[model samples]
Target: MERRKVDVAVIGTGTAGMVAYKAARKHTDNLVVIEGERYGTTCARVGCMPSKLLIAAAEVAHQVAGADMFGIHAEHVSIDGKAVMARVRRERDRFVGGVLETVDGFPAEHRLQGMARFIDDHRLMVDEKLEVEAGRIVIATGSRPNVPDFLQVAGDRLLVNDSVFELENLPDSVAVFGPGIIGLELGQALSRLGVRVRMFGVSGNLGGIRDDAIRQYALETFNQEFPLDPSAQVNRVERTDKGVRVTFTDKPKGKSPSEVSEDFDYLLAATGRRANVDHLDIQNTGIELDERGTPIFDHYTLRCSKDHIFIAGDANKDVPLLHEATDEGRIAGDNAGRYPDIRSGMRRAPLSVVFTDPQIAVMGLTLDQVKERCKGYYGVGEVSFEDQGRSRVIGKNRGLLKVYGERGSGLFLGAEMFGPAAEHIGHLLAWAAQKHMTVTEMLDMPFYHPMIEEGVRTALRDLNYKLNIDPQMIDRALECGPGA
Candidate 1:
């Protein structure tokens, strides 16, 4: 067997692994990055970039379909499914190629191609062909779509986000399971692109929002475009000659639930993702593990039980976002390269965004989290986009934005939003949360007239008043005009 030694070794060369390798290289020349699969980030390859490309197409289709509301008539708005899929694939390949180029630029000697499994705390075997012994190891193996065993009934008719982008043409209908981030984004996109989509979730969780009002608003808004059961009672899934068939109970509001069965070209499972650590043989490492067999590690340091072992990115499952993964990878790599001198890395305020239309976003502490931490020592402020100026002007006014504040300090704890331009608004709220800005302080920030951000200001104003810091407005002085 071939044997090698290194100062530090990083497993999986995705986003986290690449960042870890670069950070470790700064500390030692004897470091190598291992990749069992093809090079490229999940985002560029399948997750964020490619999904957004599909969403962009869907957005265009939706805009043309809705042009009549603006006194403009659009004729023959035919959607070419084949053409849409073609562009999605072509642009997806371009993104993946860019990531591949970056991987190619890495020093050849520092890259290893093989599946790595732990033999001991500081040793690993790569596909039984090469053995590696390192002073420190970092696991950044990323994650894959988690498919439930019951869905196996769909057999060849099953599809995941990874395989969806590979389609030659859009299907006539799709049954999307799990109304989480992936499900909502893909389900809505496909529906807007003229595909019949029925979405189901195990529980009533829409876009991962914690605030009840916002979640309800999102549920109502999405249901208007397509059938969405955030909480579904699915009976069975079977593969038919043509495709997959699903049986479930349809529970319409204020009516008795009825059992129904439907067939679709495919059953898309977007339930969630599982970290790619199970195959790593982590048991051999003698590290403390959680019930899920994932390593229990410090969030700030990204260190496993062993001083020389570290975990980061999706492998750690702390925060699965791309930016969070990048940050964790750097921390793990820096700590792994400089073992025995572990230091806590800076972690940013938590932020998450769902790219569905009228995008959904949650930043900093969620309402549930705040309640658990502060024990009802907080207040909530809300604004609905139904009457917001710019939103009404664009006919994109749907959903709500709720901001939270501490009762005593009037601190802007966090926010959950489902409204137009939420992606941009989420970033602004995240920045404010990170800066420890207060509710009144956020309101003090200039909000230009007739902008969507004005909605945010309105929420903060309500929060400021709720926090008992600002008087309840008797006069509508801030109102620039109707809808403004």
Candidate 2:
């Protein structure tokens, strides 16, 4: 077998693996990155960029449909599914091209295109053709859409994140199988794009929002966009000449859930994802694996069983967002570079956002996590978009925001919101939480008039009152700033 030695070897040239390679390059001149899939990262290829392209087309169609509400009437607002899909693929190919360019820039010998498996703690077999002997190895094999066994009957009609963007034409009707992030975003987008969409969610909360008020708002608002059943148990799928048929039953307790059948031109499975480690034969490397066959590693340092092995990205199942994957990869690379004297660093305060109208964004602690981790007193401050001036002005006043903080110290703990530009608000709360800033301190900051940020200030104000801090404290806190 062809054999080679390197200071570090990175598997899977996705975001995490690419970042790991770049990071390790700083500490060691000898490094290699291997992949057997398309070079572009998930975000650029399917998960984020292409989906957004579809969402963009959808949002335009929706806006045109809603134009009459503002006294601006629109006529003949028609869409060509083929044209819309062509633009999405065209733009998607451009993004993928950039990733390919980067991959091509790597040294010819350092880039290996083959499946890799651990032969031992210190060696790997690539494509059963070459042996890689390395001082350290980083695993960033990433993940794939979780398609269940039953859906296989649909065969070519089934669409997952990987295959959805490849559609040459938008289906006339779609039955989204999950009501989580992908389901809601694409389902709503598809419905707006003049497609009949029926969404299924096995849980009450859509878009994975845990806050009760926001979840309620999400449900009510989403219902207006598309039909949804949050309590569904998919029985099976059957192939048909036109497309496929799905059988499911409502699972709500005491409701006498009935079996329901639906036929659609396409089915999108946004169920979830599993780490791509099933083929790795990790047992040979002696790294402890979880039930999912994902390697168990230090969440902070990304180190695995041996000093030479590190796991990052979705492979570790710590944080799966693209940005977090990149950070985890950097941590893994840095640790592998340092070898036995590995260092550790904590991740940023949690930030998650789902791109939908009145988008859902969550930051820092959830109520459950707070109750379990912080035994100390905590309070929630909430506001409705109906009362917000900017939301009303924009004619989109429909959602809620809830901010949680320590009742005694008034320190900001976390926030969950379903409102316009909630993504920006989530970042603000995450930044404040990262600094351990309190309610009064957050309120001390300036809030512009007739802006969505005022909504955030309003929540902070409610929190200030809940903490029983004096109203005068705002002035005193503000006095420390310029022009006070």
Candidate 3:
């Protein structure tokens, strides 16, 4: 076996691992990145980028199909699944090609194409061939779809998030088994593609956001937008002559509870995701992982027990979003080069988005989280998408945006939006919350007129109304000065 040494060895070339590798490279020329697969991580090839592109294509197809509603008559609107897959593949190659090219530019000895396992606290055995000793190590191996034991994926009857995109043909019917981000986004996209999609999950609807009002609005929107069977816990899935049959247990009374099954061409299991830590052999290292198998680290500095072995991304378990993973990767890279200090304590508020029609974007504390933690320190205000002019112009008058704040201090706790442009607006709220901006400051800020931003203005007005202040105080405060 070949033995090598480097200053930093980054395992996994996914989003988090790539960011850490790039940052660490600036600090030391002797850095090696080990990748288990041929391509980049999930964000680049599977999860975020390709999924969004697929959803965008579906959105356009749906709009063209509905063009008749706007007096634009069309005989027929059809989608070529092969073409869609081609575009998905082409775009994925274009995006990941750049990363691969960059990796090739690094020194020959700095990139390893193999699985890395821990040999000791400071050394790793790669593909049972090369032995690498590093001063610092970063675990950027992302996550994979969590498949329950009751369900078995046989051939192509069932699939997870990663394998679903490579589907050869669109299914006539699909029974989605979870309501997480992957489930909701893919379910909505497939439904728009004319698939008879039924979703089953433990929650009344999709979970994660904190505010009940927003959650309710999202659930209602999903129910209306797609044919979702909420609160359906699938007991098992089995292959049948016709196709696949999913059995449901504990259904509501009067409903068929005895092995009610649906025959579908395909089944998607998006229940949850588990950290990819099983192969790392952490026992060989002094590193400790959390209950969920995520590497345990100091929340402030993102440092694991051995200080030099840092973790980020989904592996850290603090925040799992791609952007959060990248941010944490940068912080970890910076801190790994130096001793931990108070400066590294600065943390940013994490933001997440669920891509459904009238997509959901949430940041900071949900109303329930605030109520549980601060006990009556929170206030909430909501406004409908119908109140926004842009929503009217776009013909999507469903969904709502709700803002939460402290009762006395009026500091922005967080905001949730279930409307057009919610993902974009959620980033603004995340920035404000991270900076501890007051509601007054956010309201006083000027937003363009006749846009989805009007929803933000209206939501702030509602919050001011709850505060017993004039709804027009926003306009008045804007007139005071930019600082208002």
Candidate 4:
């Protein structure tokens, strides 16, 4: 058995783990990154980059199919799923190859195709033979799709995000169970690709999002764009001779509980995801895990109870966005390299974005969080995608940007936007919220005229109106008025 020693041992080469490894390399030459699988993490192989590539391809196919609507005559427009899959694979390989090339030249050793298990507090058994001892360890073992015990996933018919991408043939119809970011993005993309897709979720709409106006807009846009029935609940999934059948029960309030079934060539089970911590064996190390089996880290420093072991990314549980994971990883890497008393300088609020057609982006607190924090707190905001001239020109008029602020202090609590450029602007609002910027500060900034940013100005104007400020104070000279 080979024995190795390092200053830091990073598990899982995903976005978060990779960032930690890169950061730690600068501080110490004794670093090792262990990946269990042959390929890179979800984002590189299945989750973000590949999924977005497929969505872009679908969008192009949609536009080409509708060329006749704009007086450009075209007939028998079709898509080759195989070619699209090939391109997706090629792009994925290119990305993974680039990362691997960079890591190869680094001073730290790369342990590809190896699993790490804790042999002791400071010792880890890699690939069942090699013994590695490190002073500090960082866990970034991403996440996996959460398939319920009741649902059985057979080879061809049932699929998760990972297996769905490797499909040789596209399903003519699909029943997606869950109204999450994954479900919405993949469901909408498949629908646009001519798949008869129906999404079923126990919740009324996208869960974890507090903005009702934006939720309503998403529901409306999904129904208008695809075959969506938000009022249905999936009872169970079963495989049959014809295909896979999804049994659904109708919502209450005089709605019949009839068992509605749909047969599809394939079914995508994107209900949700759970942290990939099953193999870590934290019980032996005296580390704590939450109810959902995720590591419990200090909210401020991201350190586990064991001072030398830090956890970040999906393994930490609460914030699961890619950007959040990267940020948390950086904090853990920086803190792990220093002494115990040195604080991890990372306390910024996270921003989340759902990559659907219109793209839903949210940051900081929602109105519910504000109300819970303060009993007599009042929220003021605006909701409108139609008010922006950019939305009209782009021909996508579906979404609303609402900014919530504390009434007395005029401090921005949070912001939610759903529109063509909502994702980009949502980050801007998140920065403002983190910096404690006021509405007046946002209004004073120079914005390009006739752009989607006009929606931000409109939202601030509406917030000012709700605050009962004099309209004259926000005239063209102040650039805080509705059209200013």
What TM-score does model 3 achieve against the real structure? 0.90
Error of 4 at 404 (Å): 0.5
Model 2 — which ten-residue stretch has the worst lDDT? 475-484
Q: How close is every model to the real structure, measured as TM-score?
A: 0.96, 0.94, 0.90, 0.90
For residue 21, model 3's alpha carbon misses the true position, in angstroms, by 1.7
* Every candidate's lDDT: 0.89, 0.84, 0.77, 0.75
Worst 10 residues of 4 by lDDT: 475-484
Better of 2 and 3 by lDDT: 2
The better-scoring model by lDDT among 1 and 4 is 1
Candidate structures ordered by TM-score, highest first: 1, 2, 3, 4
C-alpha displacement of 434 in model 4, angstroms?
Answer: 2.8
Best by lDDT: 1
What is the overall TM-score of model 4 with all chains considered together? 0.90
Q: What is the C-alpha RMSD of each candidate to the true structure, in Å?
A: 5.3, 4.1, 4.2, 4.7
lDDT of 3 at 55: 96
Q: Candidate 2 lDDT, tens digit per residue, 1-484?
A: 8999998999999889988988888898798998977688988898889989999999899888888889999996899999999999999989889988988888887799999998999899999999999999999999888887877788889999889888888889988888888888888888988889988877665888897767877887988778787776788789899998988885454788788888999989998888888888888877887777778788788988676799999877777899899899999988777787788966888999999998999898887776665475667888988879998888888889988876545667788999888889999999988877768778889898979889998888887777755445434434431111
Which is the winner by TM-score between candidate 1 and candidate 2? 1
Q: Which lDDT value does model 4 have at 388?
A: 64
Give lDDT tens digits, candidate 4, residues 1-484.
Answer: 9998888888878878888877677687777888876546677777888789889888888778767655787877688877877888889778778767755665434554588888877888888888889988999888889887656643467778888888765678887877788888898888887788888776676834677767877777777776566556677678888678877775444775677767777778787888878887776687877777676789767888888898888877768877778888888877776636447555675578888878888876777776765455546677688656878666666688888765545556677777777678888888877766667777788888788888888888788566533334424224431111
Model 1 residue 59 CA deviation (Å) reads 0.4
For model 4 the local lDDT of residue 231 reads 54
Residue 40's lDDT within candidate 3 is 72
